[model samples]
Target: MDKFVTRAKKRVGGQSKKDECQRENLQKKPRSEVLKEEFQEDEEVNQFPQPVPWQKIEAEGLDCDYSLLFSKKEADTFFTQLEEEVVYFTGDQTKVQVYGKTYSVPRKQATYGDEGLMYSFSGVHLSARPWTATLEIIRDAVTKATGHTFNFVLINRYKDGHDHMGEHRDDERELDPSCPIASVSLGAARDFVFRHKDARSGQNRRQIDPVKLELAHGSLLLMNSPTNTYWYHSLPTRKKIKSPRINLTFRRIVKQRQRNAIKPS
Candidate 1:
């Protein structure tokens, strides 16, 4: 028992020293460069990204683990900073073929990620734009707090009360399976809803209770795996709130280039 305890203590101490050294090194360099290097994946790296170790919130009757990640002050500042720094565009997503007709998405969005990380959503192929300094800061903060790594971010801007995201799942072929998706909200508060995927089955077909959350400014929400598989989420329009809202959803995409394989007979 003594030997086991001593070994555990030594391991913990070693890990602490390693973390300290890494912190010192990161302090000496620029965040952008550090992020780029991390993407490059050449040296030792931290697996978890949460900086403050945020608390996980468990609401009754909710399927996935949810947490309140940011306060008003932090969210407000980011809203202002990002509005000026990041670019938002509309009509970029390709038209989807539904019911023999093509339709476009309701909101404007921007995608930023490392090279070769392409994302296809709503029949639109979104190529990654190079990472900007502002995004790096936000990405770094998100990763540190949650101990997760993200290669790409989808930025959605709700311009008005009418602008909203309908119920949908994040189960994309290109997405890393079971990976957690981190969302950071800025600007105005909006309604985020989650519904069970079941479309009517259980004898008599009763309605599934919908889960609603107010995604406030400077807030972070994580949609963990199996959550996406079991539930569909949406950002409902709030006609009363006229101000615009920015949502940054960080995700890890499977690199197609890396997935390509050769036949070995």
Candidate 2:
């Protein structure tokens, strides 16, 4: 026991000496100077200019509907349940590809992937699952607010501030151009930025006129005809915020196969 104690003491003493040497080296440098260097390095890396936060400046004629999209308690319960049942995939999550490169999907619960199938990040396609009772309740509320029928919904869960969806236009060939797209946000608030594709030829040239919207819990944002046609939206990352958020985009898809099959018959 004495020999063991002596060996332990010597080991502790050696570790203390190594720590002291490291502390001395660090203390020799000024903290403010080190921080300044880090700040400069960060600024150099992020060169793109960010947009201003969207604000409701004037409420003159805007028919912005403010209603309880879902009960706070119900929303909380649904999120908790979803966190458990949904299978999460990360950037390192592997999948076998049948046609092309197998891209990694984000870390979140998605019920659309095939059994033992791989997913991609670039085109993270999710099929519209059959609406649950909870989802139907919310969907009915949204339909009442927007005055439009939404046949399908694409849900996205951002587990943290780092989990982000890239900039993409939802103007796919499957969707109807005339119908409006309604998005309901729940959980943590996030910024939804929208930028124009043809800024140079149109009014805002060399300028990204982004509508940085703060999607609060149970808030609904309806994008009508012109909005989808003219702008591209993205949910950007903010390292300061650490909470999760869920966004459900309700859409009306016009099946091309159905259209083609009935034409010649």
Candidate 3:
């Protein structure tokens, strides 16, 4: 009995020594390092900033979904990378026509997509540039989150509050009405306003109020169908904002040959 007790005590001592050695090794690491290791382990168990939920923004003739697609840390990383890598149109190519007159777009813009894709708006035609590594990564994430595929993207860079988008409908002939446009915003937060098509015509047979949404950094706004069919949206100028904002509107553009069969908007 004594021998068995002695063996048990030895086993206990050995385990205690092993535990003490492990504590000493941990102590050898800097406190910050130790804490970071602990936090990392916890992070593996429980991811930080759990997936953000999508919010519905519905109104008369409006259907949209809004959500912060990425955490602030993720968004900051993307914004910095995009600012360095995105190439914008320059010179006369940047000019757009409105009301029979041409004016330089207030913001820098670029388009990237599959081969042979073209987007025309405000009398400006933009042929798609090949997708960049950063843009592909963004597109994959957006597709995974939204469950929608896009063949084209229009990247508009607002170089401060002065750069704004005029009120317009995205019901262009090349767009596929069956697909929703995923608009991803990075950097400065800005208000996106929407007005009903009939209201804009000064014929208010039905009292429809305008819809407004604040597009935040790393945010995603899905403009679903029928919403674009009845409403127009714009990012008006906010002169007080000095920081830059980048918006990527992902779309599935029907090839030119298929456009003839598309329904009119």
Question: Who wins the TM-score comparison?
Answer: 3
Q: Comparing candidate 1 with candidate 2, which one achieves the higher lDDT?
A: 1
Please write out the lDDT profile of model 1 over residues 16-131, one tens digit for every residue: 77677977998897644554455435222333323443545333333444455555654565576567666665453634545666777677788899997777755556778888
Ranking by lDDT: 3, 1, 2
lDDT of 3 by residue, 27-92 (tens): 796543443344335433223333448899998879999998877776776787688778899987
Q: Is candidate 1 or candidate 2 better by TM-score?
A: 1
Worst 10 residues of 1 by lDDT: 1-10
TM-score of 3: 0.77
Every candidate's lDDT? 0.69, 0.55, 0.81
How high is the lDDT of residue 137 in model 3?
64
> Model 1 reaches what TM-score against the true structure?
0.71
Candidate 2: list runs displaced more than 4 Å: 1-68, 84-103, 107-126, 200-205, 257-265
Q: Please give the RMSD of candidate 1 to the true structure.
A: 10.8
Better of 1 and 3 by lDDT: 3
CA RMSD of all predictions: 10.8, 19.6, 12.6
TM-score of each: 0.71, 0.59, 0.77
